[model samples]
Target: MLALDNIETFRGPAKILHGISMKIEEGEVVAIVGRNGAGKITTMESIIGLLRVKSGQISFRGENITRMSAHSIARRGIGFSPGDCGLFSSLSVQENLEIGRWHADPKRIDKMADGDTLEKRVYSVFPEIEGFKRRNSLKLSGGQRKMVAISRAMYLCPSLLLIDEAFEGLAPVVISRFRDALKKIKEMGITLLMAESNFSNASLVADRVYVLDRGEVLYEGKPKDAMNDPRVKKILQG
Candidate 1:
């Protein structure tokens, strides 16, 4: 559902992603794993058009979206959930989700008319959210806030979801909840490309893994195989 071909990204003169290439098939849960400075987030930003591409191409569903703006790409069926969980602190749970549904194109909204299903599924995955639906976002626990952020993104029902660091700094139980939610999302036929620093948590959820080191894709394979690689071990344990 998503493909990146030799894509390069730079912040001013400092190159962050060095000829990165990867593909995510429909309904697949793909994880990009890396240490602190591996450019994993930069790669994701490039794909979602948050960063300018210095070279190479990005394609989604057979269309070249290399030059598309972030808003345009999102309208084209890509949902992004950054590490910060981009939520409006003042908005209630349902109100926050409504913002995600406010895309420019009316046709795109019609195409993604699964908001009811999305709400039901998200609330099912996070039953706690249902109780807190009327609460302010800033009043939520860290994990609960994260759920709100993810649910808002999923409210649009994008074909491909780019998730950055969903499990960072959370308790194990919360991480488990998030992992289960991700699996449910995959079962619903939406593709996922996630950037995670936690190897064990990622291994539990990812079907395939790509290991990046120093802004380069050093390894890519099945999650089990990638987890066993010496390089991957070094990077994760170092």
Candidate 2:
């Protein structure tokens, strides 16, 4: 239910996304696959309004949000889990989540799962996090940090979730765990848009894949076809 129409954005003095256009249907999992500097995070930032769009439009559920502030966009039902897993190191895991839960607009909760409380939904997606609630965020491992970040975003009760670098450096087993959580998230009716560097890992979870190179879309098709394309292989290989 999110669409980016020929949007161009800049990270700062330099432009990063060049007329990038993509769409995510309701309940769909879409992946933007690219290597470093391919504009994946730029795309996510633009969508979330962390970086303003210089040209074109960004619409969620049919309403334009191109100029909306980051918090405004978030209030409209978009949750972002940044690649760096933005968390307050001094806070306990529960405290971090409490901050998220505090900012949530209760109306954003999915009607289809109205019976489930927001806390229940978050715990369902990540049952493990429930056990680590009292632990300090700085004490957690890399994968645990990622889990906490995603869980914090889920506390927002979003209809569309934007996750950057969801599979960046985790071990295979931990990646598998996240994959299972993603499946459960989609089943719960939340749309997912992920920025991933690993094409094979992204393909396994995404229904559609977009290969971006140098801030432009080089391929937009099935993961299998993208994997076999000479140009895609060339760009991803490097």
- What CA RMSD would you report for each candidate? 2.0, 1.3
Put down candidate 2 lDDT per residue, 1-238, tens digits, no spaces.
Answer: 8889999998778989999999889999999999899999999999999999999999999999999999988878899999999989999999998877777776665453547876787888888888899999999988889888988888887889999988788998889999998899888788999999999899879999999999999999888889688989998886
lDDT per model vs. reference:
0.84, 0.89
Candidate 1 on 1-238: residue-level lDDT in tens? Answer: 8889999899889999889999888888999999878998999889889899999999999999999999889888888888988788878887998877776345654655455466676777677788898898888888888888777777766888888998997998778878888988887777889999987878888999899998888889888887578888888888
Strongest candidate by TM-score: 2
Worst 10 residues of 2 by lDDT: 106-115
Which residue pairs in model 2 clash with each other?
A: none
- Which candidate has the highest lDDT of all? 2
What candidate 2 gets wrong by more than 4 Å, as runs, is 110-114
